[model samples]
Target: MTMQHPAFAKGHVAVVTGAASGIGLAAAREFARLGLCVVLADLEGDRLEAACQEVRALAAGGEADVVAIATDVSRPDQVESLERAVIQRFGRVHILMNNAGIQPGSSLFGPQANWDSVLAVNLMGVIYGTRTFGPNMMSHKDPALIINTGSKQGITTPPGDPAYNVSKAGVKAFTEALQHELRNTQGCRVTAHLLIPGFVYTALTANGRTEKPAGAWTPEQTVEFMMRSIERGDFYILCPDNDVDRATDERRIAWAAGDIIENRPPLSRWHPDHADAARDFIAKRD
Candidate 1:
């Protein structure tokens, strides 16, 4: 299907981090298929090379249109180098998908290593990528997109995986602020979007499972939804999987906000004292 977003025009350059697999790889392939030059960034390894080949096969211009860069987005220097490399090869970039992220398991007081690594890659990576490439994108004065991958846990702040939740929550907040700044800036055409994906069966979420879960979405499905949302100019591209629909997601998010508004305990949806009340609230329709 043809994309409606102006920035998706053919010949435009699109950079996708974490493109070695999952949602990031899916998005990179789609861009290549759409005739845009694609840059796939991930840690240097067989996966990155293989992903580059996968995307290259779909690229209209073949090998010349697709390249892979080994980038540790958590490092500002690497992120800056990624920008320079892209510019040197492609001249200009029109679309940036800051989708590099890691979700190692974490406890509330987990090993400092887990927390640090998660935050550095998941949150700081997005920050470094945006700051490094955003200025030139704006200077181009062409329709462009800055898509930051977020998560549902960021919005609802679920109990498990506190480090993951905190990192994604920061992504949500930072992308929001970035969008606001982009919109208010004079003569700026670059737009920021937060891509909040549902349970997608990726390497990151495999958790040793050999087969795809019935309730999860494939990365392609998630990317298709994301493109449609971007075409519609949606800032919060909240995706639904096989198990949960948009209505249910909306209710859950509202209830999360209600915790503060109603003066209830944090994450009251899981709190013993508020379980029944939260269930009843979610059950009611508008």
Candidate 2:
């Protein structure tokens, strides 16, 4: 399971939030396989321990290396404690991945709890992780990276799940600012990135389903794409799932942005009145 990837070099240390499952766990395994001492952080205690074991099994050079910390990323204190523990154990963190997220269904008129919970985890979690680990990494001369997981829903502003979309949208805005600041800071070696995943078959998107839908991409595939994008120095890693190709994604994104420029009904692409026009626009692009 050892991956000989150039994105993460040997002897480096990485801290990945939401490492208990899904894309976070998959990315953590890849980092460990590449000879980096990885720290897995997640809220699920049992799942975090099990994920650590899996990552340990993939260690290229023996000694059972890896640590699992139960952390609630929503709380600043917990995230700060996780950083302290990582530094205490591993010395320095070269990679920080704020991948913890929750997909609570909601609409414009949804309960305040749903909005609060989603924002606390998806948005503030990323903010806290960056604010805590980023400064120390910047002080070090070693090259480092911080990846925040966002969602396509945030960009397109599609129908349904408005709360989830809003939180992720905040992530997009915050990470963009973070990257800009990192690039401008003198002697800083860390860079920030936003990961926008399409329909991925993860626990968050499973919705109680036992089987994976054909339209969804597996965690492995998503991480592979992420690594490739990172190697290209991509700030926005927009991933494509099984049902959506790059071209289709581009068209959708363009149309979404065009909604403001064209002054069409909000989300008019989905509106019955604009269905024909939307299809025509896509057809012309194709």
By TM-score, the best candidate is 1
Runs with alpha carbons beyond 4 Å of true place in candidate 2: 1-7, 61-64
lDDT of 2 at 143: 86
RMSD of 2: 2.4
**Highest lDDT against the true fold, candidate:** 1
Worst 10 residues of 1 by lDDT: 1-10
* Deviation (Å) of 239 in candidate 1: 0.1
Lowest summed lDDT over 10 consecutive residues: which window, candidate 2? 1-10
Positional deviation of residue 12's Cα in model 2 after best superposition, in angstroms: 0.6
The 0-to-1 C-alpha lDDT of every candidate, in the order given, reads 0.95, 0.89
Tens-digit lDDT track of model 1 for 225-246: 9999998889999999999999
Per-residue alpha-carbon lDDT of candidate 2 for residues 1-286, written as tens digits (9 for 90 to 100): 3443343888788899999999999999999888999889998678888898899888774344588889999999999999999999888889999999988788788799999999999999999999999889888778899999998888988888898888999999999999999999988878888999989999988989999999999999999999888887889899999898887888888888888999998898899999788878766753
Q: TM-score per candidate, in order?
A: 0.98, 0.95
